[model samples]
Target: MEARLETEVCVIGGGPAGAALALRLARLGHAVCVVERHAFPRSHVGESLTPGVWPLLDALGVVDEVRRGGFLPALESLVCWEEPTGRRVRGRAGEPGLLVDRGRFDALLLGAAASAGVRVLQPAVAQRPERTADGWELPVLHEGRRLVVSARFLADASGRTACLGGRKQMVSARTLALYGYWRGDTPHGPETRVEAGPDGWYWGAHLPDGTFNAMAFVDPELLRERGIGRRTLESFYRELLGRSSLLEAWTAPRLVGSVLACDATCYRDTVPIERDRIKVGEASFSIDPLSSSGVQKALQTALSGAVAVHTLLARPEHAEAALRFYTEDQRSSAEQHAAWAAGYYRDARSYQERPFWKRRALAPAAVAPLEVRPPLSEDGLSHRRWRLASDAALVDTPCIVGDVIELRRAVSHPRLGRPVAYLEGVELAPLVDWLGQVPGEGLTMPQLADSWARRMPFRRSVAIMGWLYRQGLLTEVTADGPR
Candidate 1:
């Protein structure tokens, strides 16, 4: 006999986003069901988490469990900018984040969802979501048979598969990604490492078990122009990272995990969120990874999605408005970040000198006035500087050596060049106070670093202020106010 199930809410693709949503709805006493194609302990990329994600997991009551999953603390980040002078600048090191095992992480969260009474179907391929008379019908291929499950609301948290968005003709290809995992000599200090060059950008970080999760992102147009094929992804990445020099230290042949591949793109919907349907995570909105906002975005979608689903089940009329607001925020966030990521990629040495960049870089969409908001704390000076440069300054011109050096100094602040040996255990408060003497507004990170260096330049300043923000010392306020 073919299996049949009934649920108030159906979540497709039980990744972090889907699982989180499922757990929320199930905990709220809803008959929620989640469909996933993969079992636990599967190989997934994106092994790092930005700092604030813990709060979301905590809110979902899964924080303690996730913490037990061998999470590694990320201490700081190192970003390399290739400049026009044929030199490179390693700019802006800030506070730590987290390096996690995606396999363990996904399994833990999905398990939490299941524990919360969410009926989970694994190794099941979801074919499509068709609207039924009363609600929605989710068709899936399970055990060589088609199973149709009825749900009051259908959620597509299917990552880049874009289940609902793809079928409905709402997703747009605004950006693309090539991601994989690696396990060579792990990078020290648990930092997210970023290298920028003409061809594209590369990001990698140490995973929990001393492996590495790394990937490259490039413009689809550029990839097409150069005729990039799967077989050549390694050579392409190697050549690109070789220019930055930072990747050289870890590119040895002995890494444990072989390189894998995945694609990411920014997709926005043509129709607003309506009753009976919602898309979350990569399916709802996606941008490039330059901002490292993947997991955070997914969490945000789940949180808001839970509320929307509840409202839909309870009130029904407010469903459209709730979903509309959800999608509007998603679209606004993606567009803002995508414009910045695309512009930052254009500033790379490989693209800046090429005609392709000349056209795209100068296009109206590449550069738009952004509503600027100052960082929440003085500590986020370095991060804010990078944001402004990538979002505002680089949109106008290519990044130069001087620009990058300036960013470094800003990140370092008063601590510029002073070795630990010289400080001899002095409290860091005095040093931070001294650095705060220099105003940060209207200056890039490099300029601030230069200013602090002039005071007494011997130590590397990984601007503690930016680190402060990562440590939650600051709050981000939008134009309207704190969000």
Candidate 2:
């Protein structure tokens, strides 16, 4: 039988992003439908889940059910990505998390959405999304019948496929993961073990069902140059496993299926929302697996995207402003993740000389670091003065920016009660102020230190201006009030 209907929101791709979004929207009193091409219990990757996901699940009212699913508890991680092995706890005390079976984990979330009154269609392919009188219309094939699903708003959670193609997909890191199931004598405890190899990196984990999962991260260009992919992945994976110092202890290792590949490249494929449609999850942005934040980050988008859409629909006058907030949030998140990952590579000093690490570690903060910190020298800031300037790309959210209040800043995630301002995700506010006492050209490091010496140390004030100069948030107006 054919079907035709309209919903307030049509979420494509039944992964965590789409499912969580559907559930949130449905509860908000919106007609929401979720379409999935693959049925449940399918082969899936990205099995390691984050503890931060627990609160998200609780907010969705699925925490107990997921915990009852018999997934293993995870709390610690071991890393050998560089020299000596390092161990770190995921969180302090009661913050234990779970290690999940990807296929089962996703299925659990999807089932929760279905029970929440969300219209769900499985094994359905969505194609040809276009603008309609109400909003966006999409064609779908379900149960051997062609149907049209129209909605006033669209949510594309289709992962990297980006159901809406032709949009720009920019690669921040060129990397891929080749992995397969391996079962044998366990080499280590249940915690995840990550190692950095000469070519790329290695990740191994112990599954709950008495098996193991192994993955290798490497650039495709390296594979082709060395004729690696020419051979079957079985041989290639076996080669990687044999060479690893940690996994080499496993007895009689075996491959469970053909090796699968997933893009590990740090990328921002497209904007989060445009017009009547919003893209969440992997469709909007995909992070590198190094942080193990794939699931946590995706669900965050779902949570925020749902609220953004609700605001857009209920308050028509705030559509542009709502979408703008969502876009900036997503962009800042992706860029920050990329920068931190590079910083980690840099911290792995032993491997900094390796090409695999060199490309990532050497990049400047302005180019990749989370917050650009420029070195301070007398000559560098001695002649420089800075005055605060407004940023067009930012939406000034009112909050305490310094000891004073009522600072209008578009980007901020302040640390403590301390005031900080950011332009285009580059933090600027805490360093410069409207202190008109400095010379018109601006306060040189010596002048700035003298003016605010009571507030902070001399060298500290000097350092802050160096960063401000790199961010272009300061003005060099002459005493005449114009530069």
Candidate 3:
């Protein structure tokens, strides 16, 4: 006899996205059941989270638990990319992103979901979802027993598993990442560090427990060429890191029980949100890792999905509209991120030295015109200004501004408090020169602001170009193009 379990919502894949959605649904007084192929405390990759994560956890009322589960605060990211200056221009992680151990973090989220009255079945995998007239029938396998789960709605949060592939099978470019953790004697700072290393790129952060989290992404072609075995992948990773003085110092010999590896980087082909089912997190849209929007994107997907799911479950008549909105949002996020990745890796200045980087780095940020502004002079005595194409009034012969405006854009914050912002580029320079040459260098951001507090006019015909980088603009960048 087939066992039967009934639920209002069935969530597959107990990763961050799955747990989040399940928790939200249960909190709404729905009988939600989450099925996971793996148990809690299992290892996973993409160990970073943008500030946006805070709001999601807060909404679920699990921020304190997540914070205690070895989550490290990330101030900024030090990224080395190719530029005309022949030097790496470091970029911030958009105001204090968090570094987390996926094992503990995922477990914490799943536990919280369970506590919220969501039923969780560990080591339970969904083989397929059979469409039903009233809802959907999911054939789930837990341990050695097979069971049928009936739910009004189904969510595919199974990471790369794509359990509901019958509706849409996402096509992905094959990619590989080899990484591990270590306890070393070296000293480090609070910032999570990343740079183009021998293998591909390395990201490391200091955990609260005095240990270090580090990993290297190896080239797929090189890994194949070397014919590295499962055990040898870890050894090869160690050897590759040994060449980097900065990373090598912190990593002594260590053991990685189950080395984390993934074959999909870009989540180009995935199911769109629809009436009968929805895909969240990596299952919905996975993009290149260079963008570092992994956890942020996942949380955003789940949160936005919660709204749609709630609307549909509460008002079944408007289910189509909710699905449409969710699909559009996912498309915008994926395309914008892909464009950025293209610009970053495609530019030679970022990683021309390493053949592996040449292949991986070429992808640009999926979004065009990514709030990029010209850098400030090191001396602070002089500031440079440029015209942005997006500005309408200044489309032609735009006047130069002395300082950058709104450089400190707080990405996320609670409704009651002020959000944190980080400095991006310099603004308003022409006005400063016209009024009186402000003393350069040794000047702080505040002092620069006080000196040229008022906006002025410029006769020098500085034009802000009227270019719109909606998304996927990075696809235009090539080796032969103008740097």
Candidate 4:
């Protein structure tokens, strides 16, 4: 005697990731349902965001609404990480980002999703997720009732708890965040203030509501005995606040509330995708908040994840490939972000000896020269499997080298930050037209490189061939030796 609901997709956790996905998929004419454990306008942190988020929100048709929400603009950061005595201020006033009231921002998005034909259930807790042949059956608790939602796909947009991880915890740095809100002048006006101290680091930003939000990032062990309680947390927050000149400017500013704590560590989910279920947003992985990319990362993951899910449900034949791409890309993006944040810890010479900093400053993985295996030679025939990925519709971007309109398209990939080209900067796809119509046999990587060697040396062609192979653009085809 249980109530039941059915849909094409049931997304768990109605945060930005879940809501955004539900909105997009529903707009695509799919029956999507989003289940959330918390009610709207719930307390959540992470106000500071990256500028890159504007375009993503625009794509979702929410940018105009978000802009009119009167969120505080964040243009630059005032950093004090130089340790002994160093200060750096960087901001882009014209290209400023916003500091949001997280509760409100999240509520707006969820509401937008609901209005966009996405069925969102509030105060709903998801029980164990069971995978089915067609998709998944998610048992959800709402309004003192157990409801079963049957869907063709299940998405876990749960936050760092990553409900989808389902007891198989991924290895992650267990850094704890202790933060509080205050009514006073923040260290830097409107701009954020970041500094490194004994235990870990501190972040402070002026909220749009004429209040300030300050958070301390440190090892959980550092908070032993003197951490959670109201009095103890206030003392801990004060001790760390006193270390910063920014906080000292305030003379007994009124404390707004109790100090809240949560895990802010960087980690990735190693759980493989199963059945028709996938994880998006923090449910997939999380990184250090030091990068101030928490929200932006969630949006990016959601965007890509939507594409992946759509591909899987719409075109089952490509499910394997699409899902594979989604998982690998999400994991790699997390790894790269972790590596990027580690450098900040390592750069602070003042805390190199501190146990907290020392542990975080572990030597980053050394970058090796980009190389390809099974070598390339001119006499070999190069083969390809996947179509070339590019932003340009055709070889449209014109590049001039020695007086010729050598047009090329921008090759793009999730792992790469910018467009890439091979052999004298020509788009790899257009230059390989002859490979399909070779006279005798197929063209090897080197031959492809040589044909386009008009702007590159022979040795350089070899390198380009290897590069293309590494990018999975050119097939090795070295099995039968030059046939």
Clashing pairs in 4: 380-444, 381-443, 381-444, 382-443, 382-444
RMSD of candidate 4 to true structure, Å: 9.4
CA lDDT of 238 in candidate 2?
70
> How many steric overlaps are in each model, in order?
22, 6, 41, 5
**CA lDDT for candidate 3:** 0.62
What is each predicted model's overall lDDT from 0 to 1?
A: 0.62, 0.72, 0.62, 0.72
Which lDDT value does model 1 have at 444? 45
Candidate 2: worst-modelled 10 consecutive residues by lDDT: 410-419
Off by over 4 Å in 2: 84-91, 169-171, 246-249, 362-395, 398-483
In model 4, where is the ten-residue run with the lowest total lDDT? Answer: 385-394
lDDT of 4 by residue, 1-483 (tens): 889999999999999888888888887778999999998888889998877788889878898889988898887676878566646576654557789998899888898899999998899999998777877888999999999999998888998777777533333457988888888543435668888887788898888787888888988878774544656777877787777755643456667988788888776677535547778788887878888888888888777777777776776665665656576666668767766776888887888889898778763542333434454343332443222323222233333222122334545444343344444654455544544344333454445667757855777666755665565443333245331
Model 2: per-residue lDDT, tens digit, 373-445?
3545535545655555444133354332221123254432221111245533334433343333345565555
Question: How would you encode candidate 1's per-residue C-alpha lDDT over 335-422 as one tens digit per residue?
Answer: 5565666566566654577643443343224223434545534575554332212111111111112101001111222212111111
RMSD, every candidate, angstroms: 14.5, 7.5, 11.9, 9.4
Instruction: Report the Cα lDDT for candidate 2.
Output: 0.72
Worst 10 residues of 3 by lDDT: 395-404
Is candidate 1 or 3 superior in TM-score?
3
